[model samples]
Target: MTTVKVKLTHKNYDVKIEKGLHQAIGEQVRSVWQPRKVVLITDSNVGPLYLSSAQGQLEKAGFEVLPVEVPAGEASKSLTKVGEIISQMAQAGFTRQDGVISLGGGMVGDLSGVVASLYMRGIAFIQIATSLTAQVDSSVGGKTAVNLGETKNIAGTFYQPDLVLVDSDYLDTLTDRDLVEGYGEVAKTSALEGQDFFNFTGKIRSVQDIRDHAPELSERSIAYKAKVVMGDEKEAGQRQFLNFGHTFGHAIELLSHGSLRHGEAVAIGMVTVTRVFEAEGISPEGLTQALIDRLQAVGLPISSDLVGTPLFFQHMINDKKNRGGVINMVALAQVGQPIIVPKPLDEIRSMI
Candidate 1:
């Protein structure tokens, strides 16, 4: 078991990553806070698979357990669902001392984190991430949010989790496509960090590689994010580098009308941004092609199926990252380096 500590301004926590670490959750929480009433928030798909085991463990530790399950999907990350979960927490007789445990993927982590953040002002929460995307990225940063309509993650807060428990065993139940979707983020992180990390992902040839090698990969991704979050916890500075491909990625997800997974769209977005950088004569030697090959090997799409420069440009304008009518983009000068460039719509349009 490897442990990484995230020290934020208002709070500090530890991210514990290992295979079969779920059983130790009760003991871990006890070490942080005295055993109090606990709430386990999960989605329908994950509820049957791992929820009961978590509940049983907490109950055995002498704490009352409340399990709340929402429908599984991106659609669940909404204001309405947030209200529903808050109401459920109240009905369960929760207190300020109780903590909420997010027991699924990113969706569960985001929504439940928000619930824990807002309930009775704020309560502690733990991330028991069961998916690759959540374990490596979403579960660590303290960025909790719900999607407002078509705009992704527009309504949210910076609520850090008290503990992040990742068990690679859960990846065994993930579909090939799901695993591929996660590799996109892992690849993007590798690209933003450097050749050593990028090359590590390049050698992966199967889903089992992701599971077998997750601890190291998870640690690397978490470490990269931790530095950014620690420096600019509020995203007012260098932290924006973490959104390397998300600007175009979020636009693509919006344009697809919710069909594309976040990481899949990000894969296409990274390729699009790199091509734009290449056209501008700013990309590094052999980097673009290598990144593209790595993404393809993991089954991520290199190009968008929907083609229309005008439509794509329109979607990019609506990104939350845009500031004062100018689109702020995080573009790569080379692997492991990201520079934020503000571009006019006409210039961005011409590239499409």
Candidate 2:
């Protein structure tokens, strides 16, 4: 098992990475969560696979476990779903004293965390991430949210989980499409960390390959992300760099109408940013081609012809990173180092 401690200004928590930690969720979160009730939340897909084990573990640890299931997929991540879950918890007599156990991939983790934060002001939660995307990104950052009307994660909060347990075993159940989604975040972090790490990820082939590289990949991703998040937990400044591929990615995703997974969209978005910046002489020459090659090596999407529309740019203006009509686009000076480039919405629209 490997443990990385995230040190925030007001709170700190450990992101524990192990192969079988999902089976021990009750014991793992025991220290931080002394709960009157443990509300275990999972998505429809993952609930059947791991919920019972988590429930049994928590029950064995003497927690009164309550299970909640949300339909799987990005569409389930909505204000409506959040409201439903909150209402269910209220009916169950849950209070802030009862913690939440998020036991699935990114969607489940995001939805569960949102419910935990909103139920009775806020409550403790522990994330047992079952997907590569969640394990590497969403599970650790404490950035929780649900989509609002085609915009992704437009409503969320930064309420840290008590602890994070990442079990690589879950990657075994992912389909090729799901595998590609995981690589999206892996590629994003690799780009942000610099050329060597970016190149390192290019060699990975499948979920099993990722498992072999988990120690190195997970550590580097978490380190770069944690550094930025600790410096700016609320996205007030440096944290925006983690959005290196997110601004445009979000727009393309909305345009795709849930056809493209978040990471798939990010893959295209990163390529888009690289090309646009390179054309404007902001990034190095051939950067887009280089990213395309690496992204292709990992089976990620390089471009989306469907993203060519005025609606795409409209969504950019609505991005959370924009302020005062200026979009805070995260540009790579090269791979690894990021610079926030603010441009008027008109310039961004014209560039797109």
TM-score of each: 0.96, 0.96
Please give, for residues 1-352, the per-residue lDDT of candidate 2 as tens digits: 8888889988999888777776777788776766468788898888888888888888888899889888888888998998998888888898767888898889999998899889989988888888778878988888999899967788998889889887777877877678668778988888888888888887876656776776577777877787778888988888888888888888888888878988999999999888999898888897788778767876788889766587887787778877879988888888777898998888876786
Supply candidate 1's per-residue lDDT for 51.
89
Give lDDT for model 2. Answer: 0.83
Question: Which stretch of 10 consecutive residues in model 2 shows the poorest summed lDDT?
Answer: 206-215
Residue 337 error for model 1, in Å?
1.5
Residue-level lDDT of model 1, residues 77-186, one tens digit each, is: 99999899888889988889898889999899999999999999999888999888998899988899898876788899988888888888888888878777887889
Indicate the TM-score of model 1.
0.96
